[model samples]
Target: MNFKSILFALTTLVTLSLAIVLNPQITSPSADTKWRAGDTRTVTWDTENVTGGPIPEGMKGTIKLGYLDPKDGPNEHLNWDLGSGFDLNKGSFVVTLPSELETKRTYIIVLMGDSGNASPQFTITAAR
Candidate 1:
C-alpha cells in the first residue's frame, strides 16, 4: 500500500482503539429490568475505559441508581452506602434497594466517574 493509505489505516485503528479503551461501561442492571425497592441487587461496572484523569475529591467513581425524570430533579438519587473503603475500581458491588419509593417508574443506573455510563433504561416497580 502507498504511504498515504498506510497512514490512513493506522489512524483509523488508533481512533477505534481509543474509543474502545476510553468508553465507560456499566455491566449490570440490564435495560428494562425491574428493581423493587427494599430488595437487594448487585450494581456493577467496569472502569477500564476511564483512561487517565484526576478524580475529584471524595469521588473515586460511584454507581448512581435513580430515575431519569427531569421533573423529579437530579434523577431522584437512591441512597446507597457503598460501605467503607469501597473501591470504585473494583467493578462489583452488592446494593440494597432503598425502601422509600412509592411509585412505579423507569430508572437509570449510571456509573459515575470522570464520565458517566448509563445502564439500559430499567424500571422500579412500586415499593414493596
Candidate 2:
C-alpha cells in the first residue's frame, strides 16, 4: 500500500469525523438588541456554543447586514447592500446598519463560516 495515499485518506477521514463529533453551532446574536435600518447597531454574538472558546476569543465569524427586496415579483437584488464585514475572534461581532432601506421591508444578517473558511453560509433575516 502507498504510505502517502494511506496517510492522506486517514487525514480526510479524521477531519470529517471531527466535524460530525463537534457539531459546531451556527447562529449567534449581539448584545445590543433591537436593530433598525438607517441606524447603527452594536451587534454581538454568542458562538461559544459552536466554538469551544470565549464569546470574543473564539473562531472568527463574518457578519453581512443588508435589506431584502420589499416589492412583489419582477424585482431582484433591488437594494441588497453588503455592509462592512468584521473578523471575529469570538462568536460575537459588531456591524453598522445601512440607512437607505425601505420601511417595512425584510433585512438579512449573515454570519458565515462559524467554524471553517468555507463558502458563505450561516445567515439570519430581520424585517422592518
Candidate 3:
C-alpha cells in the first residue's frame, strides 16, 4: 500500500478509538457490586469523558433493571423500570431495589437515551 493510504488508515483508527473512550459510561454498580433487595442504592456514571461536555441539563433519561437468563440472554421482559425522566447530567441517581427481586448475580442496570450504556453484572440478594 502507498504511504498516504497507510497514514489515512492509522488516523481513522485513532479517531474511532478516541470517540469510544469519550463516550459516557457507567461507573458504579460494577461487576463486583452487590446490594440487598429493598435497599436504596446509588448508580453513577462518568460524564467527564462525554463529548461536548456532560449531558446537558434538563436532558432526561430512563434506567431499567435487567437480568441475564442462562437459557437466553438479557431479559427485559420484566420491564423493571427503576426510574425515568432522570437528569442525565446529574451523573447519578438513587434506586430502591424491589423486595420481590430474585437473589441472583446476573442483575444489570441499563441507562437508556442518547447513547445507552449498561453496567457490568451485579448481584442482588434477598432482603433480610
Best by lDDT: 3
For model 2, give the 10-residue run with minimal summed lDDT: 116-125
Write candidate 3's Cα lDDT for 44-117 as tens digits.
98867875455667878788888877888556444588898988888899998789888999888988756567
TM-score of 2: 0.48
In candidate 2 the C-alpha lDDT for residue 121 amounts to 20
**Models ranked on lDDT:** 3, 1, 2
Q: In angstroms, how far off is 62's CA in candidate 2? A: 2.6
lDDT by residue (tens digit), candidate 1, 11-126? 99999755542335677787757778778888876556545422223545566666666677656565554333355666767777778765555677766654566777777776
Compared with the true structure, model 1 gives a TM-score of 0.58
Residue pairs clashing, model 1:
none
* Residue-pair clashes per candidate: 0, 5, 0
lDDT for each candidate structure: 0.65, 0.44, 0.81
Worst 10 residues of 1 by lDDT: 50-59
Better of 1 and 2 by lDDT: 1
Write down the TM-score of every candidate: 0.58, 0.48, 0.75
Q: Which rank order by TM-score, best down to worst?
A: 3, 1, 2
